[model samples]
Target: MYVTSNFTWHQLAQHVGGIQLQLEEKGFVKGDVLLAITPHSSFELILVYLACIEQGVICALVPELTTLDLDKRIQTSGAKAVFLCPNTSLTLDGALEIDFALEQGLETQNYSEQNLTSLIFTSGSTGEPKLSPTACITI
Candidate 1:
């Protein structure tokens, strides 16, 4: 499924034309992992989330998270892989990088009755942050 931010779909298809075709011909069922690293655009986060739904793979999105936070999220999400931007760096136990240019495409996934997706994190208000979980699902 080549899960990525909004502007990279075209460029990703261009680079991995063979792989993309293989996926499409096989009903786009080859994808089982996702990597999202859009620092400047929230659209990237949104796109990746939708891609996860289409591909039926678990997704983990962490925005400007600290090293400790990254470790915790990765652990909890059990993400098979991670994709980060050129400028973003994260040190974790198991993470890989895939290179693709920015491109555009139309989103075709629908989520009318899906459960709310969210991550639990510390609020960091006091010396020790309190853990809170929020859901963003649609009915």
Candidate 2:
């Protein structure tokens, strides 16, 4: 069951900062891609997403991906790492698994909409899935 909890603004900001620190420690820098393959969504995932944005790392969120699917994503996106929920039983090879706790910290960076921030895969009517990247730019 998904349990909802209340979080103050301060808590959220700190969590995001902690996540950013973790990402940096793991050698993930701006323009690097991270593939998150988990069956379910949780608060941690949201924090990671925010952290990636703050750090200028592109995050690709995948739901319940199989090994083959995971391989395709890695190849297409050139993801430097994969993130799994701490409680998950899945294991991956040839990719760094990032597991970090959200703690207290703060590090702010400028984010431009012109730079790619996230990636998604879209299936068309009659072909292989295509990668769709998102940026912050209005145009």
Candidate 3:
């Protein structure tokens, strides 16, 4: 499937706000871990990442989409939920289906520079994937 977007900055912000609300309403709270298995180049993936950031939820952007890879990620991240690609038919336990159509909003959160934001994993050429936790650093 092809991914394209024509959203302006204002529209993007609105979408992000809506996603944040969606996440909050779904019982996700600060420090909760989420696995984003959405397609790497998709706009929905971008929204998930931003919403998690604003909500102070730790998100791991999974690099691979295979079932085995996903299972490994879910296990290692201890994710509360998993975000899949829009057209995905895979049924995973704890999968969170997001509605980008939301317009409700929530207040932005203040995050510390040391706050764990995301987890980056290696390709595991040596063995099991190695994790690199990324922090929210404000310049």
For model 3, the stretches where C-alpha displacement exceeds 4 angstroms are 1-5, 87-89, 108-112, 123-125
- TM-scores of all predicted structures: 0.45, 0.82, 0.82
Which order, best to worst by TM-score? 2, 3, 1
Best candidate per lDDT, number?
3
Query: lDDT of model 3 at residue 17?
Result: 86
Model 2 segments beyond 4 Å from truth? 1-4, 86-89, 94-100, 108-110
Candidate 1: clashing residue pairs, number:
3
Model 2 vs. true fold: TM: 0.82
Cα lDDT over the full model 2: 0.75
What does the lDDT read for residue 36 in candidate 3?
80
Rank order (by lDDT, best first):
3, 2, 1
Model 1 worst lDDT run, 10 consecutive residues? 102-111
* Winner of 1 and 2 under lDDT: 2
How much lDDT does each candidate structure score? 0.44, 0.75, 0.77
Superposed model 1: Cα runs more than 4 Å off: 1-38, 42-47, 87-94, 99-139
Candidate 1 global Cα RMSD: 7.2
Clashing pairs in 2: 113-137
- Estimate, for each residue in 4-59, the C-alpha lDDT of model 1 and write its tens digit: 54536655444344323322333433224344444554433444455444444434
